[model samples]
Target: MKQVQKIKLGISIGDLNGIGSEIVLKTFDDSRMLDFCTPVIFASAKIITFLKKQYKLSLNFQGIDDPSKAIDGKINVMNVWKENVNINFGEEDPEVGKYAFLSLEAATAALKNDDIDVLVTAPINKSSIQSENFNFPGHTDYLARELEGESLMFMITDTLKIGLLTDHVALKDIASVITPELIQKKIDIIHETLKQDFRIQKPKIAVLGINPHSGDNGVIGKEDEEILKPTLHKIREKGKLVYGPYSADSFFGSKNYKNFDAVVASYHDQGLIPFKTLSFGNGVNFTAGLNKVRTSPDHGTAFEIAGTNSANINSFKEAVFKAIEIYKCRKEYRKLTQNALKKQGRKDTNKKLFTKDN
Candidate 1:
């Protein structure tokens, strides 16, 4: 196969009523986004025109019927929605949800078929997206289903990378899912992904306990002592640098989380609460183990400020940058591995030739 020149990124323009369209326009409006990848937006041309006229965002749009028609240095809009629906800025109509779902579905098809290198999804409103077919909480659950259940959600920043064992579940049911096997699996996924995607070797990981004081050895909660602790031990035995059962209360104190590369929390809040606290409005949520790469801005669809041109595009920018970073990381690692193999092959050939001559 020939090496592709440009990195093709399939961008889903999320709920039209939300700020998804605005941020996406702002993100691609700058010429810098084209420097890294060819962005193909799966959205409507009429909506793009509406946002440009309403918010006065400086964006040039060229509509394309095929992903292959996307051009560099310009925003490409692929109208997955054949008919244009009346868009109400900041209003949650079911039309926005339907279009958002179609945009996402189109993007996913392109991604699954290797038509795009990565997917940068804009925000989707959960309440409005309640059709019989569109019942996901957000992209994480939806992508998980489409990818056939092989993925994990992690909120990431330069400091404090967090992995959630359970997401968007009721707090009461969190403990039931906190088992040693699951943590081991999550850690394994985190470890392998960091190596493959982030190029981290011998990643040092920290695991958070389910209970305060880490159950204080069953005084507070037995899940920590019975389940979490055993998992940490078994992981350590496998020559992995895994630690903790540390109370989440003091874990973020004094910036101690920086000592480890990544941390695993038993539930949603335990991990994300700290992650969002530090990186709000600028965080990138990465789905760590998907066969097809997926990422989104950490913040939600800001419906209140949807098309006012008031929404900050920082998180979306960060998401695109991270996708590029991970792509380069994967590429470099493969190059290094190939080079090493080639060198080793030369060394083996020299040894065999010397032995035969003797």
Candidate 2:
């Protein structure tokens, strides 16, 4: 019998003042989680210890200087910084935000280096995390620059999956930003992600309209009819199973979303509002179409409930599980594709030999 290798799950501790630390600790509190993957937390051991004592969690972690030293079946905390810092719960602090960026930066480096298999990030305060060095609106934008390929903010649960076409963009700019090219590119990304990451052979995708009743043939808004409908039509003509420009208002309410593998929304709120409503505590925000796998809980840093130790750990736990699943899926997809190409190569060779002899 052969022993299987465990995945190295890299974690980036988000805002120190938020429930990020609480959820991370609580999620791995159950020792059984270690059996699935080796968890490497990109934060100081002192901070985690402090958090454990504060949260009164029974979880134990080991300190390591690098991800390569991470041991399987143990919680590994890689110290990205070695300074004593103040932790003010339920408050937005720039100092704490800096630490969050440090953890994220270190974890991202390790991910790029393949030191870790997959990354499961905790929530960060978008406002507090703003600095000259880190000017991105959120994780998706930052990860898009750090990793290869176009990044799509894909929120996923067991049954529902939604991708945003224009994430982190203002509502006013959304209409103007959403062009035929942008729609086509996002559709391509979602289509490939479905087949490669989710292992869907032929994925059927739904695109929500930009306006009410999908603009009612240019009544409510011309964007839906002029841009969205035309773009989707062109994509469908390419023989891909893409459908929509459906009215967003009743798309999920009527359970029309259940018919497709995934749904593409025009903007952030348009997609996230419904997704979070349907699967708030259980949904995982997966950054799809990237070279590396990364996932985070659907919810953000709950500042009001930061230090109460009452933060729900379900989303974070689901994030960890989803990251591992996606990593394995990508690996398996690559192997199958390679084998298929090899078989085709052999067939082509045999045909050439037979043709030459005949």
List model 2 lDDT by residue over 245-321, tens digit each: 88899998999998999999999999999999998899999998899999999898999999998999999999999
CA RMSD per model (angstroms):
2.8, 1.0
Compared with the true structure, all predictions reach lDDT values of 0.84, 0.93
Candidate 2 deviation (Cα RMSD): 1.0
For model 1, residues 202-307, the per-residue Cα lDDT tens digits are 9998888898888998998798888888878988999999898778989997687999999888788888888888888889999987776788999888877876
My TM-score estimates for the predictions, one after another, are 0.92, 0.98
